[model samples]
Target: MHSVVKLADAKRSPKWTDSQTESGSDRRFSQHASDLVLRQVAKAYRIDGKRLPVLEDINLTVEPGQFVTIVGASGCGKSTLLRLISGLERDFDGEILVSGRNVTGPSLNRGLIFQDHRLFPWLNVEDNVALAFESRRIDPADKRRIIQEHLKLVGLTGFEKAFPYQLSGGMAQRAAIARALVNEPEILLLDEPLGAVDALTRLYLQNELQRIWTQKGVTMIMVTHDIDEALFLGDRVVVLQSRPGRVRRIIDVDLPHPRDREDRQIARLKKEILADLAGEH
Candidate 1:
């Protein structure tokens, strides 16, 4: 089981010595300090003047460069969990630590990709990616290079000038991925990023995402509904129970990367996972 840190003691948490860096007048933590820890995480919402709990006693830890996938039924607070981790939702009870530092709000260190591409309709591929660097003081030439490199990273080398309307669904999503990665965030949060694509495209993108994760070695926590996709890409699959979403079980995929879809172990795990989701344990 992963260790859980108490929220009250978050202020006394030890700082990661090697993860600190001086950037201008501010102290910035390196993207390399990507490990995430959640302790006693819980959330609820007010519905018709009554409180409805969504996630309860959620505790999880994701090591740096680890690919962890979350699978659960709809309305299981899967997306809400991602929102909390990404620092988009702060009104919750928990301590979310990234490299020992508490996550108070959205930071450039964490990147979020949604189910839709969410790219600007007017911006071309390269420009859409360049939007990520707009707030920084990077040189124009360096920024352009970074954009082009990320585009190439997602197999959009020749489509730099193409607009979102001109690209296929898969291509647009690839551009979104490129945009999310341009900053080289330590953790990439994906919420059903491939759910909007066709089956063949989704399969192809799964392999591509795995390749990207292997190449970048960035920590990834993806919320997916497809058990096969989750098993195929994740180092560990986190199965969550519905209603008040909670960790039901965490299964380790000991197989090496570039895993075979027809592997006997994978088949067995899939069967086991399906049974678990069906409450058949």
Candidate 2:
């Protein structure tokens, strides 16, 4: 049997420290300081010569190295909002800023993860991860070292030769995550990244994600439907209301890392969020 990569044992205390920051990379999250600001942001789509707004007046801030989760009903434009922050949806209105600079387009400082793994089938794991650095002008040796470090960070070091088909759902997602982080982005934007995995694997990968977030201290803004997952992982949870999506509320988790699933405070907050959502209907 091929050696399966175990997600639980995959993460170690990250050895890639602040001193190793790539040249010209701002390394904004090193001291826990990647302030993300969104001001009066609005997005719309046109159909049949009519404008249909998807998001409206979205204003929020994510502190550096903070884990911020967004939860809302379908059509609330959660994913669309993330797209704006990623600079993929340039058609939107208003301002998006990271570390006080306007986000005109995507840069190496921002990494994005979609729900699907989206790895190239023909590319082996290492090559797939390597794709993130195609435009970088670094030494080949440095690139190889960065890739290896990220693979270990995500727990796929030994499976570098494996193809996407050979990896399980969780492992494929891990590879995708590695690809995103290899650039050492100051912020990672996640769009329901764990939604496709099985229940058990989802739980395991959530732990792995927490470890990676802690070790790398990268600013993260993730969209998830699971209230429990949001509260567990997020320092703050932003809820949006649909029909021209808008910020309904922002709830603070106020819990420490590696939180217990059964904590009473989490349960209470969950009820509050559920009630808040139910009221929107």
Candidate 3:
């Protein structure tokens, strides 16, 4: 069960401040829609009395309202990096800051979605989404409105009572997305959210994800193996190298939204990213 401090309440909650005083930079806050800064971050695991490094020197700053996509080969720690930012793993070295404050643990301000739609098999769509609001203290009317709005945003408006198994793969994923959004998180971290669906449905959901991003104006960071998907959806693509994953390059997608898959720039960038991935072998 996930917990949340309502987006509006979080803004005013004294427990979480409105402003963050970074080491040397000017103060930043959630009103700016949340900015994520990671510096000198590294992670390792100990096995058989030996230390095994998984990621090294991962440094990035995602600005408010940006869609940053991360692509790399397996074992490159793309998902591990996402976990660090999500505050699910805190034994890492260095720092992860959200709006200038250290990310010590998971908060309602950051929502996470995985490849599998981890919906409760016993719960219907509305009930599963309603779980996000379990700890929120808002009025019932407001809670209902939030759930309805997010469902509509994900185009699952009429399937409010449908069970997860009853819906198509795409629809189930949409419900998962709605659950993530119902909290009104300022930053959404997705770990291959569309990986389980068929290719055609994956393409369609990319469009849906773009639309939702536009509607909510939240910062999004996603990890994927699909080069075309990365180019199609990201404002910027960060490529990583394997064997102690490290950043290789970050490519800017200057094209406007509803981007053309056949655009010359997209094609060129795709080739470049493919070459980069191949080089990691």
Per-residue alpha-carbon lDDT of candidate 2 for residues 171-240, written as tens digits (9 for 90 to 100): 9999999999988888999999999999999999998998888777788899999999999889899988
Considering every candidate listed, which one attains the maximal lDDT?
A: 2
lDDT of each: 0.85, 0.86, 0.85
- Report how far off residue 15 is in candidate 1 (Å): 22
In terms of lDDT, the poorest run of 10 residues in model 1 is 1-10
Summing lDDT over every window of 10 consecutive residues in candidate 3, give the lowest-scoring window: 1-10
Instruction: Tell me the TM-score of model 1.
Output: 0.88
Query: How close is every model to the real structure, measured as TM-score?
Result: 0.88, 0.89, 0.88
Model 3 TM-score (2 dp): 0.88
lDDT of 1 by residue, 1-281 (tens): 01111211121223332333443211222344368999999999999999999999999988666789999988889999999999999989989999899999988789999999999999988899998888778999889888888888899999999999999999999999999998989899999999999999999999899877766667899999999999998888999998899999899887777689998999999998888888822
Lowest lDDT sum, 10 consecutive residues, model 2, at 1-10
Residue 121 miss distance in model 1 (angstroms): 0.5
Measure candidate 2: CA RMSD: 6.4
Ranking by TM-score: 2, 3, 1
1-281 per-residue lDDT for model 3 (tens digits): 01112332332334444233432221223343688999999999999989999999998988776789999998999999999888898899989999899999888889999889999889999999999888778899998898899899899989999999999988998999999888878899999999999999999999889877766667899999999999998988999999899999999887777789899999999999999889766
